[model samples]
Target: MGGASNDSSSSTTRCGVFELSIFVAAIVSGTACSICSKTMMELHGVGIDGTMELFTKPIFQTFGMFVGMMFGLIMHWAVLVLKIPFPGYEHTSALDNDQRPGYNTTSTNYGAIQSEKDQLLASQASTASTSNATPVWMYFFLIIPSIFDLGATALCMMGLRYLDVSIYQLLRGSGIIFVALMKQHVLGDRLFFFQWLGVFWNVVSVILVGATAILNSNDDVDLDPNDAFWGVALVMAGAFVQALQFVFEEKVMSMEDAAAPPLLLIGMEGFWGTLLCLVVVYPLAYYFPGEDHGSYEDPFNTYEMFMNSNTIQWSFVIYFFTIFAYNLFAVLVTFMLNSIWHAILDNFRPITVWLTDLMIFYVITETGDFGEPWTKFSVVQLLGMFVLLYGTAIYNAPNAGSLKLEGQWYSFGFNLRGEYEEIELEIHEEELNREWEERQQNFKARRTSSLAERSPHTSIHTQALRGFASPKI
Candidate 1:
C-alpha cells in the first residue's frame, strides 16, 4: 500500500511539474544539436571572394557544406543516375580484443551503442575509401529531414547577412542548448544540475555573440534587398527544424541498418541529400529555375542561394572537393563526440571561416576592388565566447572522462564496455538475466550485511524478465 501510494504521488508530481518545460526545451535543443553537422558542412557550400569581409559573408560556410551536392548536380549527375560504377564489396575489419564491449548500467545497451557510434565516426573521419554507390531509396527517407535542413539552411544564411561569421557561429553554437532542452522534454531525459548550468552559460554566450554583431555593425557594406527579413526568417526556421532532426536522428540511430555502421550512413546521406536537391532544385533551378535561382554566371558566386561554379569550371571542382572533404571531416569528428549529436552541414569546409573570409575580402581590395574593413569583437563578446566554451565543457561533464578520445589514434573505440543504443531498445533476455545474476553475485561477493539486506536484486538484472527492455537514453 505504501509503495503504490508513493508511486501515485510521484507520478502526479512528475506530470504536474516537468512535462511542458521538457517538451519545449527538447524542440529547441534538438534543432541546435542537429545543426552541428550542418554548420560543419556549411563551410564548403559558399566560396569566399577576396573582396568580401570574412565576418561579413553571411552564408559563406553554408555554401561550403553542400559543395558535393553542387558538384554532383554539375559533375557527377549522369554517372550517379546510371549506376555505372560498382565495387560490390563490403570492407570488413577484425576487431582487436581492445575493441570488445560491455554493458554496465541500468541502461544495459548504452555501452554497445556508443561503441558502434565510435566505429562509424572513425570511418567518417578518415577519407581513405571511396564509393560510387548509394541506396537510391534512401531519398525517400530524406523528405522530412531535408525539408527541415533546407529551412534551417535558409535561416542560417539570412542570419549571416545581418551578422558576421563569428557572431553567427556563436549564435549557432546555442543549438547545443536546444539539444539539452529537447533531451529533457521530447526525449524525457533527466538532466544533472551541472548540465543545466552548462545550458545556462551557453545561452549567455549566445546573447554576447548577438551583442557583438550589433556593436560591430558600426561600419557596414551594402545589404542585398530583403536580405534581413529572409535571412532572419530562415535562421529561425533552421533552428526549429534542427531541433526536429536532433530528436529524429536519435530515435533512428538504433534501428537495424542504422546501428550497423556510421560512416556508411554519412556517405549515403550526402549522396542522397545531393541527389534529392539536384532532382528538386535542378530543373526548377537550372532549366525552369525560379527568378531566385539567378543566372549561370552566379553558380559559385553567392553565399546566399546557389554557387556560381559549374561542371567544367575549376572553381566548381574545387568547391565540390572542399565540400566532400569537410563533410567527411565534420561527420567523423562529431561522431566521435556523440551519435546523438547532429550533422549541421555547415562549418565543415574551413578551419577559421571568418578569418578566411577576411583574407578573401582583403585580396579583393588589393585587386582594385573596394572591400570593407572589419573591426569587431568587443571585450564583452570575447568574454562571452570564453564562457560558452566553458559551458560546453561543463555540459559535457558526463562524458568529460572520455575527453582523451579526442585526436587520439588508438582511442578509436578500441575498448568498449556497457554498450547500448538509441533506437534499438530491446535487450536480450539472457543478457538481462546475466546482468542480474552478476549483480547478485557482486552483492554476495561484497558480503556487506547492511548492503545485502537492502535488496539484492536491485540492479538492472531485476528487470531482466521483462522482454524487449530498452535502456534509458
Candidate 2:
C-alpha cells in the first residue's frame, strides 16, 4: 500500500509536468481570442465616429466589456459556489494531489458527493474568514490593480485603432523590462545574470521594433511616421500600467489564503473593473474620439449603433462572448503561474495573431496581395520578430542549473528532472526503515510469548518425575 501510494504521487507529479503544454495552449487561445477581437475592431471600424462602439462603435464596445464581465461572474459562481468543474479543467491539481482524509476518489458517486461536501465546507470557511472583518484598506488595495488593468486595456483599444496588432504586440513586449524592475524593487526578487541579459535583450528588441515602425514607414501599412510615433507612445503607456497591474496582482494573490478560490478573486476584479470603466467611459468617449480621426457623428450614436444595425449588434455578441472566454482562461493561468511567466508566455501573442491574420487574409477576407503594413510580412519586421524570440528564450532559460533544461512547474513545486525523484527516494527510504523497525519488534514479542507458553509444561513434567522417585524410596 505504501509503495503504491508513493507511486501514485510520483505519477501525479509527472502528469503535472506533462500538463504544462495544455497550460500553454490555454494561454495562447486566450491571447488569440483577444487579438481577434482587436482585429475585428480595426477592420470593422470601431473607432470611425471617434466614438467607443466596437469596430467603430463606442456604446457597443463598452457593452461588450460589460457582457464579458458578466460571463466571468457566472463562471466564478458556478465553480466557486455551485462546485461545478470547468470542462477540460476537472483536474486542478493533477500533479500535486493531496489526498485528504474522507476523500475517496476511487468511488465515483460517493467520492463526488464527498468532494462536493468538502468544497461546501471550504466555501463556508472562506465566508467565515471574510466575516472576521478584514480591514477595509486591504479590500481597496486588492481593487487598485484591477482599475489600472482596465485603464491599460482601454488605452490598448485606442492604440489598436492606429497600430497593427502585430506592431502593437511588439511595442507591448517592453512589459518584461518593467516587470523585471518591479519584481526586483517591490517584490524583492533577484534575477540571475542570464535573466538580466534576457531583460537587456528584450529592451533592445523593443527599441529595434519601435524604431522600425516609426522611421521606416514606406513598407509599413497605414501608418505615417507621426501616427506611428503616437501609436507607439500610447502602447508604451499602456504597457506601463499593465506592469503595475501585474505586480499588484501578484501581491494580492500572495496575501490570499491558500484555500481561497482564485477565480472568485478574479471575478471580483472584473466586476469592479467594469463598474469603474462605466465612470470613465463617458469622459473617454468625449476626449478620445479616435484622436482627431474618428469623431462621433452624434453623442447619442454610441447607443444608436446597436439599435439601428443588425450586423453591429451581432458583432457585439461575438466580441463579448470571446472576451468572456478569454478572461476566464487567462485568469486561470494567472493564478497557476506568477505574473512573470504570465508576461513571458504572452510573447507568443504577436506570432499567433500574425499567423491568424495571414490565414484570414488568404482565405476569408481576400484582401489585396499581401505586402506592407497590411500583411506585416516585410523583412525588417521579420528581423524584429527573430530578435524578440531570441530575447524571450534567453530570459526564460534556467537560472543556475546545468545546460540541461530542468523544467519545473513552480506553482506546484513539481520538477521534471530526477532532482524531485531524489528527494522522494530519500523519503521512501525513511519509510522503509520505520517499517523494518516495527517488524523486528513484532517478531520479538511473538517469540517471547511462545517460550512462556512452553515453560509451564516443562516445569510440571519435572515435578511429576520427582514425585515418582520419592514413592519408590
Candidate 3:
C-alpha cells in the first residue's frame, strides 16, 4: 500500500511537470513563430511604406492562419468522432457515461440485464446529445468572435512588420490590462487593490515605452518613427479587439445549456473563422491589392507571384506550418489549463521573447531589416519594462499579506512539523462497543418475538438463512 501511494504521488508530480513544460513550450513556439512571420515581411517588403501598394500582399500569413484553423477543426472531429485519444491521454469516450443512474437488477441473470441496460442508456444519451445540441443558427454567434480573432491576428501581423520583436512583445503585453478590466466589468469579478495598482503600472509602462519609441525615432534604427507609432497603434487596437473576443467567448460558454467541451468549442470557432476569413479576406487580398509603391506594389495575382519568387514561396510554406503548429499548441494549452494560467504564462512572454530575439539576432546571422537588437532600447524603456514586470508580479502574487504570522518562519499558510500537534477526533471505544452490543441484543430479542408471531407455516430456520434474523441467536 505504501509503495502504491508513493508511485501515485510520483506519477502526479511527473504529470504536473509535463503540463507546465508543455505550457512553456507553447509560449516559446508562439513567440518564435511571430518572429518568423516578421522576418518574412521584412524579406518580402510588405510593411515598408504605409502608402505604397504592392503587387504581392502579405496575405499569405492570413491564408496560413485560415489553414491552421481548418487543421484544428479537422483534428478535433477526428478525436471526437473517431474516439481517438489526444496524445499523452488515455483512450476513452469523450461523452461521459459514468454519471448515468444505475438500473436495479435483482434476478439470477443480473449481469446480462445490467449490460443491456447500460447499452440502452448509452444510446439514449448519444441521441439526446445530438438532438439537444446548439442550433445551427447559433453557430453564427461563434463566427463573430472568430472575426475579431482574425482581425486581431491581422493587426498583430501588421504591427510586427514595422516594430522590433522586443518592443512589439512589450506593447502586446499591455493587452492584459484590457482583458483584466473587461473580466472585472463583464464577468462581475472584482479586482483586488494590488490588481488595480498593477493596472495603473501597466498603463504607465505603456506610456513610457511609447515615449521611448518617440525619443529614439531619429536614431539609425532603419525604421521610420511614424511607422513605428502606427505599429504601436495597430498592436493596441489588436489587443483591445482580442480582449473583446475573449469576453465574447466567455459569455457564449456561460450561456445556459450551451456548455460544451473546450475542444469542441475551439473547433467550432476555428471552422467558422476559417470560412469567414476565406469569404471576406481572401478575395480582398487577391483582387483589391493595396496601392503599389516601389517595393510595396500589390501583387494582384498572388499565385503568380508565389510561383515566381522561390524565396517568397518558401517563406510562405514555413509561415504556413509554423502558424498551424502555433494554433494547435495554443488550443491544447487552453484545453489543458485554465485561462488565468494562460494569462500568467502570457505575462511571462516578454522576457522569453526578449531573450529569444536577443539570442537569435546576436548569435545567429542578422538579416538587416529585422529591426534593432535589445541593446538599442533606451534606459527609460528598460525602467518601464522593470516597472511592468514588478506590477505583474504583484498582481499574480498570493494574498500573503492576509496570512497571520506567529513568528518569522510561522504563518497561517504553513506549519513547522516539529512544533505542530497532530489532530485526532476523540472516540470512546468502550462506550461505542457497549452501545453496539446492546443494540444487537435488542434486535435479536425483537427477532425472536417476531418469529413466534409469524405464520405457523413459515420456517424460522429458512428466515434466518435469508438474513431475516441472526442464525447463532
- Candidate 1 — what's its lDDT? 0.40
lDDT of each residue in 287-360, candidate 1, tens digit only: 54323234322333454323332322343345445545443334332322221233222212111444444554
Write the candidate numbers in order of decreasing TM-score: 3, 2, 1
TM-score for each model = 0.50, 0.66, 0.68
Q: Model 3 over residues 1-473: C-alpha lDDT tens digits?
A: 01111111111011134456667777876776766666666554223332222323445576566666666666656765664535311222112222111111111111222344445644765665455455566566677777877888778777766667667777776776886776666555445444565667778878877766656665756658898788889888887887676555544543434433344556666777677666777656546534443223233445555555677767777766666666555554443432333444455666767776667777776664343465455677787788777666545434222222223342324332221111001113323554585466445434432213212232322221121011100
Please provide the root mean square deviation of candidate 1 (C-alpha atoms, Å): 15.8
Q: Ten consecutive residues with minimal summed lDDT in candidate 1?
A: 1-10
TM-score of 2: 0.66
| Model 1 CA deviation exceeding 4 Å by range | 1-139, 218-233, 256-260, 279-315, 333-336, 339-351, 354-377, 398-472
Tell me, by lDDT, which candidate is best: 3
Q: Number of clashing pairs, model 2?
A: 17
165-215 in candidate 2: lDDT tens per residue? Answer: 677877777787888777766655555445566677778778777776775
lDDT of 1 at 427: 26
Give candidate 3 regions above 4 Å deviation.
1-19, 45-58, 86-114, 131-135, 253-256, 282-290, 293-301, 332-341, 366-371, 399-473
